[model samples]
Target: MELDYVVGQTLAWLRALGIEKDTFVFFTSDNGAARVSDVPVPGGGSNGPFLCGKETTFEGGMREPAVTWWPEHIPAGTVSQQLGTVMDLFSTSLSVAGFSVPDDRLIDGLDLSPVLHNNTLINRPIFYYRGNGIMAVRVGLYKAHYWTWSNSWEEFNQGINFCPGQEVAGVTTHTQQEHTMQPLIFHLGWGPWEKYPISAVTTEYQDALSRITAVVEKHKKGLVPGVPQLNMCDMTWLS
Candidate 1:
């Protein structure tokens, strides 16, 4: 209800400015909810059926729910299930504003015009990063988690801290562990509540993993070795 009120206020402001039809509005969050506002998992917030919470590679951590609006451009009540990431916002907004992205820098985003306008399904692979390292990759509807950790406190609660009528039992949570040599694959489209790994039986799993690996490798090769442009120009850094 609060979010709806905020959305209404935003549309009212746009309408008052007489640019409601010309402007594009996008609503999304950087990551999933936190279990506890200050601490890690099994604390306060909820991600519904998504496994784990923030600070992890699970869909519950990175796969956010979003909404976009563009008056006549984006059809009214059109719901597209296209796969995308927060990184795509840059390129998509640039395209919407009729601006060309600089060619000198390596951009990790793609223009999502086709997907938004025509409801096209693009096979865009998304890489999940935790700090400086990549922990997982998603190609289409399949995700390959190269590294995993017990992302919440509830995982290790063992029914001691669990509230009545909770979906998961206390014994469900587990302690953190190290990464394994083999990756675990999941069909995200089937829902995150089902923690079944499909890679062992599905032939398409290997193909998807291969394609995602190639994408990651390509992006790595394009990286420029240096401090960020913003950091380099800081007066503090020069001294």
Candidate 2:
């Protein structure tokens, strides 16, 4: 695959430059793989065992495949299930470079050096946003879905149509509608295929929900009003 070739070259280049040990290379996709129905068959990408695929706030959409490379910094053959986001790169890179993040601004990213260096656990809740609105949040092993949508274009019925016994090929129709309702809770530790509601069954659900709700409230309090800017000068090439 092209991705494989590119990554191989990247590592090779880093090794040649003698900076592979010092450089931090994080390889990951922006979202999960495309569903089988969305792409052409014979080589259609799978979202693995996750519920849905790209373009939705499901675990499949938010949980992406990632690989971090830092030869001497990050331990080899070590895998961390730590919760992290792309936003953390800003602060993490700065920290690794020995620079301080600005104290005047709200930084949603926590320093991931500890997690990478010592395998520390990060219990922060990751708020999943679809555009300007918050769709869901995941803290620890629990995830709360406040909004719902099917991964593929076929919508809610796609699951039934694409299952093992009920497999239907080349079905593309927009029959699902966006939905808003009470939050649906899931414990990801239970496994990717377990989507059953366990809020009533587990006492930790309400406590975790309350903590996540507070996180949202604290985030709201940190919001700063935006000020529009305009360019007043024109630039010309200098002799």
RMSD of each: 5.1, 6.4
The candidate that achieves the highest lDDT relative to the unseen native structure: 1
The positional error of residue 70 in candidate 1, measured at the CA in angstroms, is: 1.3
Model 1 TM-score (2 dp): 0.78
Q: Give the number of colliding residue pairs in candidate 1.
A: 5
Superposed by TM-score, candidate 2 places the C-alpha of residue 229 at a distance from the truth, in angstroms, of 11
Residue 182 local lDDT, model 2: 45
Worst 10 residues of 1 by lDDT: 163-172
Deviation in Å, model 1, residue 63 alpha carbon? 1.0
| lDDT (10s digit) by residue, model 2, range 1-239 | 99899999999999999999889898878877555453455324567777555665666666886788998888899988888888888898898888999899778788887888898887667888876677777778877766654434444355432222212221111333332344666778886543575554467767766777777788768777564353344243321
> Which residue runs does candidate 2 get wrong by more than 4 Å?
151-181, 199-202, 225-239
